[model samples]
Each structure stands twice: as C-alpha cells, then as structure tokens.
Target: MENKFRRIMRTEIHKGKRVHLFHDRLVTPTGKEVEWELIMHPGASAVIPIDEDGKIVMVRQYRNASDDYVLEIPAGVFDKPDEDPLVCAKRELEEEIGYTSEDVTFLYKFYSSIGICDEVIHIFVAKNLVLSEQNLDDDEFVTIERYTLDELVDMIFDGRLSDNKTISAIMTYKVSLERA
Candidate 1:
C-alpha cells in the first residue's frame, strides 16, 4: 500500500529549535479542501539499554510540555535531518545512561503524535553494554534508574511509567524476549 494523501500546499507558520509548524492545505478523500496544522520534527531515536544484570535503563527528566518529571527510555533527536536513527540511538545510550553497546538492534518505530506531528521515533534495544561516563548536554538534567523487565511491566499497568514511547518500547522488548 502507498500513501494517497496529497498536500496541496504547506504554509510555514514558525520554525523553532525543535519543530517547524505549518498549515497544510489538502484535498480529502471526499474531495473537500481542508487546512490542517502540522508539526514537522527532525525525528528522534530511543534505546532500551538492558545492562549485564538484566536491568533496563531509564531516564527521569522534566518535560516542559507536560510540566512534569517523567520516566522514559533514553532518547534524543537527530543532530541533523539526514542522521541515521541507529547512530542517534547509539549515541543516546552512551550520553544519557553512561553506557555503550556493540550489539544494538532496531526494535520498532512510531510517530510520537500521529495526528499533529511528524516526529517518527526509531526505537532500539542495546545489549552487552559497556559502562561509560555519561555525557549530558548542557541543558539536559536526567537521572538514571534501572529496573527489571517485569517490574517495568508492573509500572506500566500500575500507571507509574506514562511515557508512550517508553511503554511501547518496554512491551516490544518483552514480546521480543518471549519470541527468543
């Protein structure tokens, strides 16, 4: 299958540090013209770093949009638009969690907000991690936490870990474990 949706025009609304907003004019399936707000992002990559003790690494950071400190898998946006998501994921695993891995594998990808944003997050699982010094960016404040896979599942059901990407990556990894 191929995408049939065609944009007639896209008018730029604003370009910020992280996202570009636009008003896109399109023709619906019913042939009606409509204008929709879209947020264009330089896609991101995330990692589920399972260390030697089988503990999954997580990051606790404050999200400005939600105005809350949230627990999530280590993730970051591409430094450039053409950057490979796998490369970004590898970098984040080291920078955010103080670990590096030679056995990184792609797990899944998804739009963070499909209806309004084009932020596709590429998720990966990194194993055989080597402990390294965390290299946090100047503006980043993150606390590292490690948990068992089952404990994370419990957190998901108990409404503790609420980040969608984290939930999705955990479940995806759990399922992968079952298959292996």
Candidate 2:
C-alpha cells in the first residue's frame, strides 16, 4: 500500500528563533486536497541536575502558557543547529539553578507535542555539582528549588510535578535507580 498523505506544497507563515509556523498543502489517499497547520521547533534539552546528595535541582517560573508559576527541571532550546544537547543541558542547569556538574549523563529524549509540533526534548542527569552564580537569560524569571529523590518521586505520584520533560526525566531516573 502506498502512503496516503503526500505533501504537495508548503509555505512558511512565520519563523522565530525557536519555532516556525507553516501551512502545508497535501493530498489524501483518495486524492482529496487538504491543508495543515504545523509548528516547527529546533527542539530543546532539559536537565534533572542531581547533586552528590541526590537532590534534584529545579526552577520555579511563571509560564505564560500555563498562567502560573510552575516548578520544572531547567530546560532551554538549542538555538544553534550545531549545538550539542549536553552543552545546552549544562548551560540550562547553570543558568537556571546556578550549578555546574563535573559529569553530565544523557538520560533520554522525547517529543513534546507530537501532534502539531516537532519539538524534541533531550534530558540529562548532572552529578557532582558545583555551586556557581546563575547566568539566567534576561527574560528568565526563575527561582531555584531542590528536592530529594524520594520527595521528587512523591511529587510525581501526587501530580505536583506536571511538566512533561521533568516528569519523563524523573521517571527515567527512578526506574534506572530501581534496576541498579
């Protein structure tokens, strides 16, 4: 069987540093014309920086999309096409939580909103952290928060931790620890 959907043409409606909006014209299996609205992003990275004592570093910031301040692991988009995900992860951790790690490990990567957006989030675990000055972006309004691994697990179960990338990283770490 042939692929039903075929992109006949596309036009970029808008573009930004992190995302782009596009209008795509396509044809269905039956040769019906259709148009789709799509959002594209350079993707991002999130870090669940864990100190030597097993405390996970997080940040509380107001997300306009959520209309409230939410606690989440430090994360940022990869602005440069050639930027390493680990570097972005490290930068985010230091910028948002004021901590640098001697060892950063890639945990997992996943898409954020797969239906309409091509945003992939790379997650990392940073260990052996060194306290440092925060170099947050001018637009970033964030406060640092730390929670023990056990406390974070409880937060996940109680739904207090709602950010997608944060949840994924914590859950991955939890499972990996259990297996280890």
Candidate 3:
C-alpha cells in the first residue's frame, strides 16, 4: 500500500501572530486535483482547574470571531513550537484564572477543526489548586467564574457552554473521574 493523498503545492496566504493561512493543491487517490484553504496554528493547551470543593475555574471573555462572550476553560497558545503543553496549561491556568495547580494530568489532545485547520488542543485536569494573581494579556479582558461540576455538565448539555475545547475538557475530566 502507498500514500493516497499528495500535496501538490502550498502558498502562504497570510501570516499572523497565532495563525497562518495557506492555499494548497492536493492530488487525491483517484488522481483528481483540488485546492483547499487551510489555517496553520501553533497549537494550544486547555486546563479544567477543579478546586477542592469540585468547582471548576472558567473564564468569560468576548470572542471577536463569534461576536459574543464565551465561557471557557483557561487556555493559551504554545509560546514556541517546542514548548511543553503541560507548561502552557499551567501558565494559562494561573494567568487566566489566578490558580496554580500542583497536580496537572493530561487528559487528551485533539484537533479543534480538522476539516479546515491544523489546530491541536491539549487538555488537562488541574487539581490541588492554590490562588494566585491573574496575569492576563494586555488586550485580554476575562472574568473568572467557578461552577460546580454538575452545573458545568448541565451547561454543556443545555448549550450554555458551547466552546469546543471547554466542553471537551470538562466532559473528559468528568469521565476520567468516574473511571477512577
């Protein structure tokens, strides 16, 4: 067996701080050629910070792409391509929610939008958290909130928590706890 898909060519369309857009031509297994627009991301890490009382730390902020305020777990893009994802998760948890976790366990990683983008998100469950000072980015305006695990699960099912990463991380953590 051999590879069925081949990238014919790629052209960078735009380059930004966090993402780069590209136009590419590919040849399929049937020998048909097509063009696709792809977004290249540096990847990111998200953390579900569960406190001793079982409350999860979350952040609410305006998302320009969606034109709405979204509730989500603390997350941040990898500072460098070689940066450790767990380190990124820890930094984001502290920076966004003012909590530092002594126990951070990796849950899973997945692509945010496989159809058009190459953005993988590493999810982690942070336990034994201690309060710290939030250090949000200059342009970031986030409000930290804590919710019971049950409330978060309800929000996920009721459509109140719609951010993909947040939902995935929350559900994954809950399932992991059940298994343990």
- Give me the candidate number with maximum TM-score: 3
- Model 2, range 28-134, lDDT digits (tens) per residue? 98888999989988878898887777788789998988998998999999978668999899898888889888699988888898889888889888889998989
Per-residue alpha-carbon lDDT of candidate 3 for residues 58-136, written as tens digits (9 for 90 to 100) = 8999999899999999999999877899999999999998889879998999999999999999999899999899999
Candidate 3 Cα misplacement greater than 4 A, ranges = 1-3
Winner on TM-score between 1 and 3 is: 3
The lDDT values for all models are 0.93, 0.87, 0.92
| Candidate 3 global Cα RMSD | 1.2
Clashes of each: 0, 0, 0
Candidate 2 deviant stretches above 4 angstroms: none
Tens-digit lDDT track of model 1 for 40-96:
999999999988898998999999978999999999999988899999999999899
Lowest summed-lDDT stretch of 10 residues in model 2? 48-57
Q: List the residue pairs that clash in candidate 1.
A: none
Error of 2 at 113 (Å): 0.8
Clashing pairs in 2: none
Winner on TM-score (2 vs 3): 3
List of clashing residue pairs for candidate 3: none
Q: What's the CA error at residue 167 for candidate 1, in Å?
A: 0.5
